[model samples]
Target chain A: MTYDPVLLANIDKKDSHTLPVYQSGGGYRGLRRALEDMSPADVVELVKQSGLRGRGGAGFPTGAKWSFLPKNHPGPVYFCVNADESEPGTFVNRVQMELDPHQVLEGTIISCYATGASTAYIYLRHEYPLARRRMQAAVGECYAAGLLGENILGGGFSLDVHIHVGAGAYVCGEETGLIESIEGRRAWPRIKPPYPAVEGLFRKPTVVNNVETLACVKQIVDRGADWFRSMGTPPDPNDPRDPGSFGPKLFGLSGHVNRPGCYEAPLGITVRRLIDEYGGGVWKGRRAKAAIVGGLSTGLVTEAEFDTPLDFSAPIRAGCLGLGTGGVIVLDETYSMIDFLHNSCRFFAHESCGQCTPCREGTQWALEMLERIRAGRGRLRDLDLLREIGETIGIMPGTTICGLADGAAWPIKTALGKFREEFEGYVKEPTTV
Target chain B: MNVLDAETRENIDTIAGRYPTRRAAVLPVLHAVNDRLGYVPTEAVVELAELLELAPADVQDTLSFYGFFKQDKPQGEYRVWVCRSLSCAARGGEELLEYLCEKLKIRPGETTPDGRVTLEFAECLGACEAAPAVLVNDTLYGNMTREKIDELIRRVRAGTHHDATE
Candidate 1:
């Protein structure tokens, strides 16, 4: 599997919407090849070997994720592109969508053929108007070229791509949450066990994949899996990135950095390199204070661990941060830990959806305490209350119908544990809320 | 406001036609209306319901439940939506939102009397490290500052920023 970064090849500073240009570069060739030459199994096999994984923050193997669909469940299997990329720090999907939407459309068409799906849904966030426009145009272009809809590319397979925009909700980024939203419900997440593949949107067998993951499939089928594997840091023979980690990943760098945008780099690239080379190091020489590896739900790692290679297992092994959404956020000296945690708690509280009692009450309680501490009203008990709130939600993971409780709980728990001292000091010298 | 012109309606209808289910076209209709009117008004919601053959209540729920739907309230001519998600939050999204409010002399979710700008908070505009970022209507102004936000509002109100219809 080659990591050519060609997916991002068409990006130009002067021209953000570059789908037409991507077409000239043979962008949909993979979809063409699959429709004309291969069977669905062959397409799936190529992706399976390519080691592609879900880029929608989960990192699940793309081939395996598709395989979860029942082989003979029904005829109308569905492919839902999780284009609702609202996870904080994760903006790579939008860049890819805005720049080369045809690539996603092409990949989606191929995926539909492989999974025997006749219908596909691209559930995008409503906030991304430009991306929605680009994607809509690209889908239109694909339909014009006979690469979509009935008898695609004259290959005798019919596929239709629909772009559904979500009202804003971070939980909607969750696969089930997205499914529920597409079904015209409030964007609350549903319990797993029936994962989207089993009973997704309208209770059908569906394959919901991230925008980046689906795009990778088009390239894998076109270039072959071995070439794709060659570009990423080979899994360590001695201490290789775990079996779980594989291939080049698209990293979205943001925060206190000079240059911040999307970059397609190998999975094991160091956080230091991302901040130093790609991010142009910390701004104004303030020095890197802390970094959030994935997104908000991911645990925080301080500057001392910046060199930790960013692989699925590497960050966890470093024991500082959780591999959130592969969104590396660098915070410099100007950041206040107290206010930062309050802001995070507030987001969790606001987005809890109140489905589960623990998440509903606990997030609000935690935010209140964090807010009080930030507002200089912190008694020592406020820190303890924050800890208690985290504990209550921590036990609510499998208890809740969805993982939202767990998602909101994990960060609070991790933050309280990791930055206790900073939180503790706020009890004595709190910053105004 | 029936801000969508005939050509815009045709374009929007084309999107609605692509979906097999009328419910699927909800987002496209809202987008078309928002693009044209700068927000989804009650009239547009009713129009979307008629177009999609769904009840107006259904469209209304969809619009109000989702945070992105800017309703047809008296928004200032320009709106500043600041990102307040975890990534941005961790790196001073709150302070930036505050800075904008102070600079514009309007709290979040409040429209200035002069109709020049309305400042509001958003949940993650997706550019986290560009923390302190704000979306001025459709365009993203990353790495935001009070001065930059003020400059953006002045430019938009002064007819310098690209109009949404463009």
Candidate 2:
């Protein structure tokens, strides 16, 4: 790991979750700097220069997202910090919210100021009760200390931060779905363009950001934009659209690893280094069979591809979805590929918003097919059918409203593409008999 | 006929006021009622509609979409959610859940006869690092083992709570 742990610095301290403990270590100094010395546009410019990407799967450029709010809009612009860490094999937001909530809050306040958002909401997952309690308390502390709500630190800007808890829906993690949930509606994600930035949350412009993305905003002010950009990959000058993964990321390492926990490492760290150096290596002296590139939705990395860097564009080069929440789950050799695909497929099936027919029905059908294969009743031709379902369901293919179909498709594609023999061996048996 | 009491109604109104539209306050309002009343009664949904100035069906429309709300009846004293996602499943979470069911003499989503616990299969509690993790009501117990589960069940049965390791 080339970078020291920045976000997790105060996590292990005795009273880390408390505001005093956080502030004592120059916590709000970034907020103070932005509030006292700089303009809101300055903050946005600095972030744009830093090349920070969203940590919540999409890897969208944060500064670009902030700049998307229509200039001088007629209505209230909202900023929603997504703390809904419901992705399978992911818990980065939960740890940050539970242990270092003020960091997230400080980043949130700074982002709100830069984006001209007068109202902000921390959309916390319902399952995370502990994170909710601590974050709620931290919000109160910030309100009391003039860091949030009504002329924050006398900076001539005011923002109201509220905690809106989710009710056990993974779809709520999707930006538009989050907006819908907060509006007291069923958490079905809306179709874009009048994207959230234009018309969202009571038909007004809104900015939805990941918890860790906002935390990065606070650190960018503390450290120079150059310092933030120095760590992760720079833009591929060849690809104009590639914004390049930058800064330290909270990589949640789990499954078959000795030291399975959240680690703050730079964006370009390889799977080998992350597993051996930080994760204490695969458990029980077993060889790693496959690794989820970054959460189940991102798909799997074969043993040969373990050397691939986990940066945003690198994962795509490694034939998976972009670094989707940086949740790396290593599966040792003893683990079954059938189990892996089943769980990944099942999650997408269960969590699909059910609005889009291809994602809703397609995911369920795929999962049922996997269950049949697992139950020793699958045909040799069923694998091709599964692939066909996956290929047609995602937004990229124009079959679904959201990227969820794409997320569900990945593991199936990767598992079948890379670990086909394992799956073939399982299915070939029932077919021959 | 009167489902929401004076205190509950006041609480719902306070929650409803937080949002721009009463329709938008349906979730937080229902959460508050669910937290206090154990489960949201169908009649209370009607009361909340009147309070928020929406039709009862509108409130119910949003209410039924989310899985956490229990409209039929109150849940058991404790809700033990065993995660069965990839990480946890790889690390004995499936077996642990089965062990729990066998010991409790009830399948998942069923409450024990004594009304002490409600076992459910959680997708992922975002505690993958602590694979084989279970949430005993609101507290997440990470690095869970059968022995740890035994202690947890005993504690819950005894009507007690313990702090999660920091």
Candidate 3:
């Protein structure tokens, strides 16, 4: 299957970050069309028909998420564009914001219009100083050109966009956590049931969408829903269900790959093709030993599963987790699975917001066991203990306030389950001959 | 000691105006204070609390949650963050960090004797395309080598390196 660059079509153009260059490539047409012609319900229905799913790990339908907002909520409705791309192996959103800030801004404006939101916030990570500057500049440009401020393009829809830079915390990427961070508090994710659509951002109806997810909205509006649905496979075959991971996705390929960068490809493309064709295959002519197909939180996939379609459903059906933010980290023959798992465990342990007991305690205990095994001081029973701890934290959903604990546990459980021998080999008793 | 000058206070007010509530501007105001002063001093926190209409403890609580803000004292002139995450680690980011430590005669998370540079390890700066990346203050230098580290150190010491924020 050939790759079609929808989100990244203008990324390579010179001066692509500027409004003029972006406009030259037929940018902001989505916002203009939606404001000039379509109603809020019409825009939402178009997206629903487009079969667009959230690009931020969870493959939730983008239109469904927007439709959750109450039509006539008395108070102010808010939209938050999640630009905090802190997932360990994910860097695609960074490229989107840095290369084409206006694309994200335009998508966000269209979303705000569809959701009837007057205020929108772009929650950016602190590490991305360059992206923030570009976004700020672009916002200023939009205001000056009558694209953002009052009565946008004389369509009688006024929206104000603000950029909020986050402090160093991985959990802020969570929608509710992001809301909390924007509200000037610690990024502890709030309990749901009063979902963000119902109540968020100072207890107002809010819609929190990822940067990449919103970027897709622009194309869905500009090209129409049929064009959007024609790209990827559907979830079911005869009388299909949800749109099965449709549209072009940005895959951040790194680790041991010859070319480690973000690649734009259609969903359901084979992982082997992604590595062999786009990533230039494994680095130094080494065979791929294992790979973390999605982000660090997703389960590991061995070379035998290399042919698995890089979509939202196939990997989960193949005993691995679903395609997360599509951050693929390849491990070569020289890489150690145990070390990789250890690093993953340490990251989760350090980042588990400590909101729930199972997550806070389980993450720390799992790391200690992994460390003990790594240090060659492991008894045979440590492996079972690690699995038990991981299952306690992750096997059951809603074990923690947020998915951080689950993220911590899935990698450990999957790594141990797949590469138990490698872990066991590290457990050596004193030379008792 | 009135750590927040008139200019910093005015900046905080402008930031507060961007949000519906003044409390929403806490992070940006703290960043403003950090930019003016090397770190967010305790006195500055007290002043910020008063400015934002909250207790000093409330300001301190928010400050403590984040690792980016330096509360106690000033950091070095050039804050060097070496990426030590999986992608960069696979590309020898740990070795580059060690090399920087050896060349500077200081440990990770510690400042140099002359207070010119402070070395630390960052999880991921979202620039995995160029692995083995180093963030000198706000600027990111990717695909770094031992020679690049040496040159970076020299340039930082000479105060000639371009700031990424600029």
Candidate 3 lDDT at B79 equals 91
Number of the top TM-score candidate: 2
Across A360-380, the per-residue lDDT of candidate 2 in tens digits comes to 999999999999998899887
Each model's RMSD to truth, in Å? 3.6, 1.7, 2.0
Q: Candidate 3: what lDDT? A: 0.86
Reported per model, the fraction of native interface contacts reproduced equals: 0.62, 0.89, 0.65
Q: Which of candidates 1 and 2 reaches a greater TM-score?
A: 2
Chain A TM-score for each of the predictions: 0.93, 0.98, 0.97
- Give the alpha carbon lDDT tens digit for every residue of B22-125 in model 3: 88899989988888787999999999999999888988888888888887678899899998887888889888988888888899878887989988888788
Q: Please give the distance, in angstroms, between residue B84's alpha carbon in candidate 3 and its true position after superposition.
A: 1.5
- Per-residue lDDT value at A351 in model 3: 78
Q: Score the docking of each candidate (DockQ).
A: 0.49, 0.78, 0.76
**DockQ of model 3 vs. true complex:** 0.76
Best by lDDT: 2
The worst-scoring run of ten residues by lDDT in candidate 1 chain A lies at A390-399
C-alpha RMSD over true interface residues, each candidate: 2.6, 1.5, 1.0
Superposed model 1: Cα runs more than 4 Å off: A1-4, A13-20, A231-242, A319-322, A394-396, A431-433, B1-20, B30-60, B70-74, B86-93, B164-166
Q: Candidates' lDDT values, in order?
A: 0.76, 0.89, 0.86
